[model samples]
Target: MLTALKEETYKFCHEKIALLGLLVLLVTTLYSTLTKTINKSTLIFAFGAIEWIPVIIIAVGAAFFEMEYDNKTIVMLLYKNSSKLKIYLAKFLVVFCYSIALALGAILLTFLLSLLTVPGQYHWLAYYQGHTILTNLLLNLFGAVIYCFFIVGLSFMLIMLVKANTVVICIGLVLAYFGASFSTALMHTFPTAVGILKWNPLNMIFISQQLTRGSFALKSNLTNFQLIIATVVYGIIFGLLGYYLFKRRRV
Candidate 1:
């Protein structure tokens, strides 16, 4: 498994999808901080705008496997005695780790930009006087990464089911674009179902909103703990489904 992971990581690095994702985060972070008067708190929120980037990149990375299938190269990998689970896991880890790295890179770049642009205008410890800038950044980073994991899991399931990059990309973008609104509408229209709706995987896509916006988080009717649980449960479910399908798929 470690060897498989290393090889996949090497492939990911060679393909440069992770590099591209990092570059996107860099550009978006610069555009966000330079174009707007954003402080540390707001800077954290701004980077969340491009959180879908990891999903997009991960989807693209998953397509490499689809290409393997199309080219009949995956059979070679499968024939090497590596369990299908390990192969699936290697790809998933590549995407998942990349997602987390992208989020961290955004946080770092946004902070540096904030330092250069905002200077002494805003204190890093402003979010909570008790918490330092680094602490708050970690919290926001955690929030962003939780959603990234959820999206990666969703991508895994989609890649397995569709086996096409374009469809996964389209569906991912659509969900990222409107998933929050749809959930909000559902919650408002059927207030009684809010409890159940909060657990929906799509509902966790914009979890950063809930993390940053106190009022909105309250309105979400889901405590941060519940949201975390929902994200983890959804990730696990999608990962299992993807692996199950991949194990039985004709390569």
Candidate 2:
């Protein structure tokens, strides 16, 4: 298992795709850091920075990493004494870690750079705006881990099931941005769309915004208990399905 993990990590590290993702994440972090202001204009930029980091990581991991398998390289690992389970774990682990790292890196860099560039400049925001440097850092850091895991894991599962990476990437990005909005737009016309919105990952982003601003989080009213339960159920089902697909795929 360790050997499999090491090999997978090495492969991911060497990929130009992974490097580019890291680079983009860092650049965005630096940009956000240098311009730390609170306004409607910055709101769009903030969301764009945060949203694109995960979307890019998820797209790359979903669409490109599996190319090696499609070209028969994955099968070669079997001859190297790697079990199907280990192989699946290795691949999943690499992508999962990659996603988490990119997300956290961007968030931390933004927070740190914001401090360096505009000390006490973000004071117009909510809770963190008035807090100490370490306090703000801690808040964002804790929030990042909880939120990153679910989003990245959810997208990684989708990538695992879809055979065509490019198609999945395009569709995933479209869904990433417009899915919740479209679903909400249809909620009144199509009641079932409301149910679909319950599980939409974009809701998590909205939930975070509400919580950070000291407003009522949509999930907090217990109005979303069913959605939360359904999400947990759906996540388990898909994760197992991903594992099954990886283990059973024929060369």
Name the best candidate (by TM-score).
Answer: 1
1-251: candidate 2 lDDT, tens digit per residue: 99989998887787788888877777765565455554432432342355565566566666444767766776677889557778666766777677667656655565555556555665534444455434444444334334444544555566666677676667657756775566455454665555564555445443323323444333332233443454445445555677676666666
Deviation in angstroms for 58 in model 2? 1.3
Candidate 1 RMSD to the correct structure: 2.4
Q: Candidate 1: TM-score?
A: 0.88
Taken over the whole model, the C-alpha lDDT of each candidate is: 0.71, 0.57
Cα distance off (Å), candidate 2, residue 178: 1.2
Candidate 2: lDDT of 228? 44
Local error of candidate 1 at residue 146 (angstroms): 1.6
Summarize candidate 1's per-residue lDDT along 205-232 as a digit string, tens digits: 6566556455666556787777777887
Candidate 1 segments whose C-alpha is farther than 4 A from its true place = 128-134
Error of 2 at 225 (Å): 8.6
TM-score against native, each model: 0.88, 0.71
Pairs in clash, predicted candidate 1: none
| Candidate 1 weakest ten by summed lDDT | 46-55
